[model samples]
Target: MTERFASLMERKLPMLDRLAVITARDQYVRKVLIPMFSDEALDSEVRTAFQSGAGGYIYQVDTLNTAELKLILQEYSWADIIEGEPQLFTQVFHVVQHSPDEAFRAEVLAEIGPYAERGEIDGQEYALMYDRVELAAGRQQLYGSQLECLNGQFDVHDLKDPEGVDARRASMGMQPLQDYLEQGRALYGPC
Candidate 1:
């Protein structure tokens, strides 16, 4: 890496560290907390503790991370982040994904499309964020990357042109819809 690239990478380490911890906790919520809540026999006290503790952690961390990321994005663009690999900016994507600021996410979504097309950012990441933005606007997602868990069942959010969703996902370097849903099911429960 060039000196500048190395310096930028070093600067991203703290954000990456935060993303790693938040992701592990998110996985725990999906893999453990959700299932525990689904169980008809789960103890009320245990469920309440996990709900307030784990759920609150995700909320708090995402809030802080989102605020930091918004300032970072204001100072940088996709061009500034491009390095040897598209994943150099994965932390940015994850932060935007978790951000509650729909307007900011939408702005980043627009800014990243060209980068994804140029292969400077991961297309799958772009697709995922695009789906998130679209869904937040109460519109159908072009790529069915966003999933929801209602009750004990998991499924893709409303998708546009469902019949050709796999084709759209493929163009974005994503797995087929069924495979994506199945993977989410593996982590989050039955689809």
Candidate 2:
């Protein structure tokens, strides 16, 4: 090894994890812009169409490319970010969980699967990660932990097996699915 590498090994400092930087940028976009605009709000960030006459309505628009441009940059950045081998997935996970980059968060969760399964990491984190990914993918979450309600009912997309999901959850260190949902309802108002 070179002298610099030898010194690095001795000190045990993380050598510039580019993935962390990428994750940070993505996180900023998610936490700031998406939440600020409620995702859909950005669709009409600078434009509104109102019917004036029977003929048609003109759109009051300004900087229509803003949101699209931001998304394009994010997508491009992700491609480059994934090109390298990421060593600091734990850090990446922290950044992603707080951010709305659900797809990237799911990717990080997938990377953590082996560690989580082997008891190297908290199973609750693993379960939450699994739920996040499923919810992101529009699937019935396996844990049935995270939930939302519409019309006084849990808005779970489509849970796979209502009968035995708890067994699956317990294997990954989670409460029984029914118990989880009941708690969820209590906390989130019948959701």
What would the per-residue lDDT of candidate 1 be over residues 15-94, giving only the tens digit for each residue? Answer: 55654665554445456656665454556676566656766777776677677666655665566555544555785577
Best by TM-score: 1
Off-target runs (Cα >4 Å) in candidate 1 are 1-53
How far out, in Å, is residue 141 in model 2? 2.2
Q: In model 1, state the lDDT of residue 136.
A: 92
Candidate 2 worst ten-residue window by lDDT:
54-63
Query: How much lDDT does candidate 1 score?
Result: 0.73
lDDT of 2: 0.51
Report the C-alpha displacement of residue 125, candidate 2, in angstroms.
Answer: 1.5
Instruction: List the candidate 2 regions with Cα displacement exceeding 4 Å.
Output: 1-95, 153-155
- The lDDT values for all models are 0.73, 0.51
State in Å the error of residue 26, model 2. Answer: 15
